[model samples]
Target: MTVQPNIQGQAQANPVSEIWYTRCPVPTTSGIAQHFRWIHQEFERHGIKVESIRAAADQAVRNSHYSHTQPASFREGGNVPPIWTRANGQDTVVVGITWVDEEQLILVRPDSDIKTLADLKGRRFGVPKHDTKIVDIARGQDLRGLLTALDLAGLTPADVEFVNVAGGEFDLREQGERREGRRHGVVEALLAGTVDVIYAKGAVSAALVVKHGLHPIIDINANPDPFVRVNAGTPRPITVNRDLAVERPDIVARYLAILLKTAAWAKENPTAVVKAIAAETSSTEEIVRKGYGPELHLHFDVKLTEQYIAALRKQKDYLLEWGFLKEDFDFDGWILPGPLELARALAADDAIKITL
Candidate 1:
């Protein structure tokens, strides 16, 4: 699984076309995406006009974090302009994976006596519900976390009551309407005593636990397996369109370079990152900073270590076994290294670090 991004000869390109870089709601990527204007200005040197598309607030819930667009929408006979995407480990759109250490927290009411994984035996587990055609990768990932923790307790899914709480988007909110976002769904359920335990991801989820003084029973960060790591954390990647990587490899490389550089900046300037995230998310810097607890590291590293690849394989197997994916594809071929390799070579010597 350790993929050393191979340095290759640059491919020539025709007149550069517009670049639509889409982003998801994950904290680090969302914060970075909000600052993409600077990234686009840099892209101008390559004769490419890069446009950052912040998917609709609800778009991630619908596309499973991948932005939806007509095939070849960004290029002539090229793959869609989804330079980054999120699909279940079962989906075939994966091109590369960036191992980010964001963790999901499974919390219980403060009054609950569920102090250990074994205590969850008969407790109600709350999973968020979304009304979208896109695959619910978050739900599946949370379930995997639950399953993993249960296994440690010598239990299984059948030992607990699984409930889909109301939290995702609805049709009424599609037309510039207001509705409750899924961020508060689990906490609401817990507060109302509807579920004994709930799984949450990101800063908002982190806040819910702290504000309510809930008990965190399982932190996905403690899991050593890659499958659970990705499910409970942010080991996913910033995927790109295959056609873009093939046709305009330079643009792909440059784009990735900018992202890698930004990631480095985030690591060195936590306060600035927090401020930027607050402004981008319209939340207080205090809340954003709290979400970025001491355990959260914002740096980006693109190493496909053997452990990572094996974990991905196991994830694929689990997804297939659970009927989340109907067919399997060549996982090895889906990985594109040229862009990452080129990005490393083009980046400033001190701007980014690559560790295998």
Candidate 2:
């Protein structure tokens, strides 16, 4: 079921004198970025400053530019902000949620003899390069999903020979870097028969199966466990810096209210939303349309639902078990419900309608 507040009313006319910065992990070409872009003025109207700079999990590390930027509000695909914050001795609190269970597919060439997970044993598995050191958990999601699937099939990494395939880098040439690369190198590797089996993500991956006749051998989306789902690229959490959460919670609530409004607007205008995303990402309309699928249509609620907390804890535990975490912290304490709670309360009051 979808949940959205009635945002057709007027936004607050009086602007509070507070300067706050917000950032979303979605690339400029993605739907999330488009929605954020559309609501830029709305956030400003509420006296909240929006940080238009796009920050990736790879860049939100200790001593990185994103970490130093100190955005008061942020959104990320996984439990990345929490992980990075804990590792860097920085304090941040997660306040809002947007659940999206993404699809990660295990594919094989149509002419290949490999037909099932069992057939993948002793075969060359093409893995797009993933950074697992201090950052880049976002890129590692598919790899972790692939590993979980292998384990479920009574296989291990030792059973397959891993082939390295080029993937996107955090360094953008637009920032005047010398390197330029495509993010779909895995698709290229598969088409060229560089590997026997591969793990692919999003619309481009889906297109390979539909148009190029690649065989989808294993569907990770079929798995029902939250442990698997957490890493599948859903459960986007909106976080706030600890100081902001404590010092100026009202500003944080107002920021979250704007996010909810944007989601509601997008829900009511799917066509425009899709077109905006397609144009921004330089992807074809068809690819952008199919990329969202059912996962991205979920409710963007600010409440810290019980299911969300459980899924987040499961992710933290699994990451620790997999040695991805250096140490454990209080996962429960990482969530602060005050701002979202305040936002919901404000939305319920008809005496106070929000104006854009």
Candidate 3:
């Protein structure tokens, strides 16, 4: 079964408007409320206020990566968390906390000779916008796979096609029918017979698997270790809105602190968190226990370090090789850790008080 995000409450500060932190759900991030109960106790004594919002993966990443940025702008790719490097620029966070799962690469057409990933050389490929970024990240280690992607073609651009689809957001099927500016619309060309393959995201992935006769040549394994890839190449999240950050440093830091603590609590209390999350997720108590509940190995800390920064650098390189981001881009500059670090320092007084 597919897990859809829950759209919960908005923050309403009536009398004491000063809150300690706010939170957003990481895309596909399971079992948070389980830990929030404990995090809430830590803030209660501090008179800190807490808030939460939820949505699909990317939206969730954008909104909650910070406590202050709940309902954050969709355009701000800047606030991406380190935990999600494979997609949404989350390489800096510990691996396995949030991971990329593949549904396999399948041929949607009958005459398609793209039987194996290596057979697709010079053949056209399509990536619907829905889970484009994440999927790209999942395929990060497969650069050589691109050559095999082009229709088993020993042919160059003149020999085959790389179709462009203007897909819509969230829904992959509507990608072709959606407006040009809409995200994930990159698959229309495929639908119109202009391209050979359609690489799509979730809803689109499901649609392609059913209607278009999708076939799988790629193996999507859960990346167990994201940190190993981190090197000097990681892109630091940039705070381009200099004026906003400078003007509201305190609020920003406090918000980040809250999220850090939330991540920490979530990592520390897996069983409790998973049970609470079980209330929202599709997994059973037995599954949660068997999967992520302890035997699953989830982490509790959210601290960034040289190791994490390095991992991001490696991912940035992968993006560059794929022409997704600039090759010379300085990931270190993009990472805005001042607020998080400051919050961490101030958080010395922060105690873990909440219980299951």
What order do candidates take by TM-score, descending?
1, 2, 3
lDDT of 3 by residue, 1-356 (tens): 01101101112222233332222121122225323454445445546554433322445533343312332211111122332332343222221112312222334365566676555556665543334433333233223233333433344545545544443223222012412123224434555656666443322343454554555454221224444322111222322132323334444444445445555666666565556534433334543343232432244344456664565556555456666543344355455665555556545556233344
TM-score of each: 0.77, 0.76, 0.48
> Which order, best to worst by lDDT?
2, 1, 3
Model 2 accuracy (lDDT, Cα): 0.57
Best by TM-score: 1
- Which candidate's lDDT is highest? 2
Instruction: Report the candidate with higher TM-score, 2 versus 3.
Output: 2
Assess each prediction's global lDDT (C-alpha) against the native.
0.56, 0.57, 0.38
Q: Please give the distance, in angstroms, between residue 32's alpha carbon in candidate 3 and its true position after superposition.
A: 3.0
Candidate 1, pairs of clashing residues: 1-304, 83-239, 98-237
Quote model 3's TM-score: 0.48
Tens digits of per-residue lDDT, candidate 2, 1-356, equal 01122221112332334343433322221235334453456556655555533433444532232243454545444455456556566677777766654456788889999877888788877766754334555345556766766887799989988787755434321122111123356667777888887775555455566666888887676678755656634566666677766666666666666556556555666666566554444555566555556434334444588988777777667667766567888777888887777666555553223332
**Clashing pairs for predicted structure model 2, backbone only:** 10-354, 10-355, 11-354, 11-355, 29-281, 100-234
Please identify model 3 stretches exceeding 4 Å from their true place: 1-113, 128-160, 168-194, 200-213, 220-261, 264-303, 314-330, 336-356
